[model samples]
Target: MEEILGILTQLGLTEYESKAYISLVSLINAKADEISKNSGVPRSKIYPVLENLEKKDLIKIKQGRPLEYHVIAPEISLKNYEENIIHNIHILQQKLTRIYEEKLPHVNTPIITVEGLDKILKKEYEIIKQTKKILYLRIGFILPSEIENIKKALNKLINNGIKIRILAVEECEIDGKVVSIRDIFEDMDVEIKYKQLPSAQLIIRDYKEMFLVFAENSGMSISNSNMVGLFNTYSVIISNYLSAFNKQWSKL
Candidate 1:
């Protein structure tokens, strides 16, 4: 059946090998020609397919005048397949997790100043995307045009089971419409606290990296020339900001 063939392929069998094995299973024991005829595989391909099945431990050859192929029981073969798969997955997980946790070489300067509003927003999105476990945000007034972008990024992390905590300014005016920053993200899985914040925003990712945005003027849109950003992967600076953020967060 088509479904059985699909399942066999998923278990690491080639299509021809699966067909040949199924035919041999039905016959209990068969010659290559008989397997080819029963499985609708070309005669030229059947011998190689049966040999591959034998190598995979799904079939065995019964020595005879004309060598016969015998199918291994599905229960036994599949149990061995499942155990191999689990062992491989465990090995991969251990190796990849070590690589993921390894620290990178430090640069000449740990802190880098980023200019332009658009570039700062791009860095924020990039940092958040790299977050593996948790994120912390102390948000200032953001332009309406960019709020959706931030929300979408955070939503993706939430869906991935990343823990996110936010501290947002009470409200901001967007094109003559007053919007509550908390209300915008309330539908998401993140926890948010409200307070009036200054014209700077702070974001920390997994306590490994930090991004800070500062606007020179109050009550002005952050998309203006006065916006500047500071970014760093320095552990000490990240810890300090995280402490301050937690202190402020507890008050709200």
Candidate 2:
């Protein structure tokens, strides 16, 4: 059947080999001429196909007055093919991972700037998702609209074994309306401290990358009020930010 031949082809059998094997399975101990006739493969091609199948252990040959070909049991042939595919994939994985690691250091770090509340929030979420070890936040205040989304992203990082430290201004409140930082993250296992209300907003990940927001009342409203942020991965710049954060943290 065409469908059976297609499945065999997908399993790494040549079309002629699949046809010859199918024909031989139907006619046990079929000779080359009979297999070609039944399978519609050329007589000249059928011999080579049979030889290839024998080499793959997919068929057995009987040598008498004329050679005959018999199909291997489907269960045995299919299981062998599956095992070989898995083995090859395992080898490729190790080789490819090594190549990726060797090339990773030469890759350039990206610097991006995002504006508006929605875009900034989305970029922040992406950075948090990529954090492998630690997430550091210094906020002047929290916006009511963005709190839920921020909480979800930070919770996901925390669940993935990332440590989180949040430093907020002394009067840090949600939208300057209600709910303090302590109230929002009370149930979460993150370090929270109050500083002398920093004018800048920062989010650092792994001490390698950071996002700095500079806009008046940046985290208060969802309005597109020139709330600009710079995303950088330069190691020295991030290290300087880390140093400042540590100094601010110690004084709190």
Count of backbone clashes, every candidate in sequence: 0, 0
Where does candidate 2 stray beyond 4 Å? 1-110, 170-179, 218-224
Question: On residues 147-168, what C-alpha lDDT tens digit does candidate 2 reach at each position?
Answer: 8988999889888878999888
Write one digit per residue (lDDT tens) for candidate 1, span 62-109. Answer: 888888888889799878878988999999988885675565324323
- C-alpha TM-scores of all predictions: 0.57, 0.55
If candidate 1 were superposed on the true structure by all CA atoms, what would the RMSD be? 8.2
Question: Top model by lDDT, which number?
Answer: 1
Model 1 C-alpha lDDT versus the unseen true structure: 0.82
Q: Model 2, residue 87: displacement in angstroms?
A: 17
Clashing residue pairs, backbone N/CA/C < 3 A, model 1: none
